[model samples]
Target: MRRSPWATLTVLALAQFIVVLDVTIVNVALPRIQTDLDFTADGLQWVISAYTLVFGGFLLLGGRAADLLGSRRVFLTGLALFGVTLLVAGLAGTPGALIAARAVQGLGGALMSPAALSILTVTFAHGRQRNIAMGVWGGLAGLGGTLGVVAGGLLVDSLSWRWVFFVNVPVVVALIAATPLIIRAVARRSGHGFDLLGSVLSTAGLLALVYGVVRAEPVGWGSAEVVGCLAAGVVLLAAFVAVEARSAAPLVPLRLFRSRALSSSSGALALNGASFLAMFFLTAIYLQQVRGASALRTGMEILPMGAAAILVAVVTPPLVHRFGTRTVQLCGAALSALSLLLLAGTGADSGYASHLLPGLILFGAGVIAVGVPAQIAAVVDVEHHEAGAASGVVTAFYQVGGALGLALATTLSVSRSHAALADGMAQQQALVEGFHRGLLVAAAFAVVNVVVTLASPRIAPSAEQIAEAAATA
Candidate 1:
């Protein structure tokens, strides 16, 4: 019997949701994890960073593997590994063990994410079907962050922090059992080799760069250790680019940047991601630190944003159809900038109902407006065979932007607080000063996104045109 395409898409979407949720789930659980594992103040970031580094580093390689090996095979293998990793992470006795397990989970996610996306690209015949499918995919991806916070709060409050990891096991098991019946098998392509050197250089360079940025607050930018890591990271990335230019089977095809829409959309996405991640991290902290809210209250307070985002995501396709992708994206960027500006006014005395909710709604709407169009534009011209790789590249940069954004916000916040402390300001005043500085930085990043979005190509292909191109490819 033939498998149902809808079933395949459903399973794939669920898998993707799980992977993305894991990326943010640990945020709410950080305090709990710290208390249980005896983690130092600096070590708290590692819980999130460990997963991000491995996931971002191997994503290109994972996409290539899905193409060469076989999507179904890789998908199943990744699911199994992911389940095991989650189990190990949940059962971990020490911080080191948990971090290692998180890294392993990231490896599995890198493999699974591209494979799931590749399956969707092939299974869903392009046109309105593909557009709707992509919209659902994008929506689920957006919802992952919100659900992570809510779910993490419930689990952490009701059960143990380990339940956060354990919850993934049943989901993985169900997916593995049903996958064969839902997803069709694609024939494996031949004549491709792994770009091992390129992978190594890219991964190591990114890890080093992130480390340097994260440590800058404590060690100071002038420290030899920080300088050495940053310098080495740059040299390694340069080498990676050189290798890609010369290699027969490059992990990242430099030619992808030739398309103006693709290039501009990618740049805009990086900036957008930086702002979105910064907002999430900062808001989570603000609710806890300033308002003295519990995890549940913080998660609930942010529910308005998620609700607004869902409404926008639902309306976005028709808006794009009417106004064209470029116009919608430009509008989205402008609105996001305005949202950030509004958020910058938030202070200790501000109420969520009066001050924060409006900003949250605007932020949600703006992000959906920009996010959908930018995502669509990024993959507009790619061949079907390269769709997975294209998606991988976009996701990688998004994660990179997220990690760097958090580090950047942290740095600004710390610097402002430090200066205020040196000036003999009250602790509360210093913290508020830091938060304000971070908000301004985030707003600046969003404004940069506006410029990048404007540079995107004005031409918007119809659903029919997109389907025709995919069919021929």
Candidate 2:
């Protein structure tokens, strides 16, 4: 890189942090947004769901375009789009305008994220530098969630909730302008013809799938809209797989799945994502509603989890070097399950220190253990041309997993809460009962991860062994 490689990484890392931050930031500001826009309780969720649906749906397409069209160009375009819509969202006076803006923001995120990851992967050679980059990338993802909650609470309390939307402008503008100066551009390679049909099927299919999952909580799975969406999603996705298998220049190269490293990493990421989201959703509710903590205080309590994840992220490269990717991933899964089981013990009267903190720390460390190495495994074998698409697949699994996990947890928790209420438990106590059940389900997912990690063969070679083999070969 003509510019310092670290400079390129810093800019890309900042951009990604902003992207992930938006995912959770608006949550703290939801009440303010609802009141300001006069949004019905039923309609308010669309603000968040719209972003996730579009972001998850089009990610693969975005990643493919980055590889074929040009990662630098795609990254800049997406960043610009996100910045523009962010301003529009901040200025929006009506519910429709804000919701529409949020959807567009998701599009920008879809376009930007994989391109950024692809760029990062190529910027540093695949070794210690690459591992460091992955650690930063993964760590930023963890930090972003905590920052979102804390920053959102501060911004909303000190200023208007609109600041949550407005805050992206400076960071994005800087990245966009710095792109040419700091980031080296990669030469474009010849690609197979664009698979338009596959693209449409994949994008539409994912959108429908995520939309269905998102709606399941509010409307129930039996609702016509939900059932129709879920069925159509399944069919369209099946069609997408078929198209990819046949297409010469498929958006997602089916052959990539031939790499156990990439495929298994993707699966593990999905499970980790499920556990992560379930923990976030359940714990937040437990703090705010059951424990009567303020939004800022809850954010404060969650800060340690982020801190722990970051700490693990820093040490993970060495751990992988000594232990290998499979071992790190397996141990992480085990830790995550243990953490969830700890959390499952939470009661209506439980204190954060006595109960939540131990679980949160373990969960955070476990996520880093799971996420950083899985990320390394995902793209370790990738050629430059496939980096973007591979990144997209990993990202897609995470988004889908999070949506599915959250839906499952919410359904289980709500049902349990209802049962408790019917059995004459107080509202608060009933809510706690439901939360406990939901947590156990979350714990179960982590345990399942343990089984899968144990059963699945090692996806990638040990770090030093791969380096040595590459040298000899």
- TM-score to native of every candidate shown: 0.91, 0.85
Give the clashing pairs for model 1: none
Which lDDT tens digits does candidate 2 get at residues 1-473? Answer: 45888998898889989998887677767767877799753355567656766777678778767878889999999999999999999999999999899888888998898788778867888787876676676567667876997887678778888999999899899899999999888666576656778767866786676667656656777999999998998999999999889887776788999877778878888888888877776776677667877666777788788789878877886777777778998999999999988988988788789899999999999987987777767776666456556767776777767656666676677777877888998999987887888889888888888876775556445666444222111
Instruction: For residues 1-473, write the lDDT of model 1, one tens digit per residue.
Output: 98888788789888988887886677777767877899754455667766776787788888778889999989998889899999999999999999899888888988898788778878877677876776677667778866888888788778888998999899999999999888888777786698989878987898788778767877888999899989999999999999999999898888888878778877877788788877876777677666777777777788788888888877876677677778998888888889878887888779889889999899988987887777666676666556545656776777667667766776777778788999999877777787788778888888988888777787576766443333221
Off by over 4 Å in 2: 1-7, 30-49, 91-99, 118-142, 180-186, 213-225, 380-388, 418-425, 464-473
Local distance difference test, each candidate: 0.79, 0.78
Over 4 Å off in model 1, which ranges?
Answer: 38-43, 93-95, 126-139, 181-184, 381-388, 422-424, 465-473
**How many clashes in each structure?**
0, 0
Full-model lDDT, candidate 1: 0.79
Best by TM-score: 1
- The per-residue C-alpha lDDT of model 1 at residue 174 equals 99
Give residue 159's error in model 2 in angstroms. Answer: 2.2
**Local error of candidate 2 at 83, Å?**
1.3
Query: Residue 20 error for model 2, in Å?
Result: 2.7
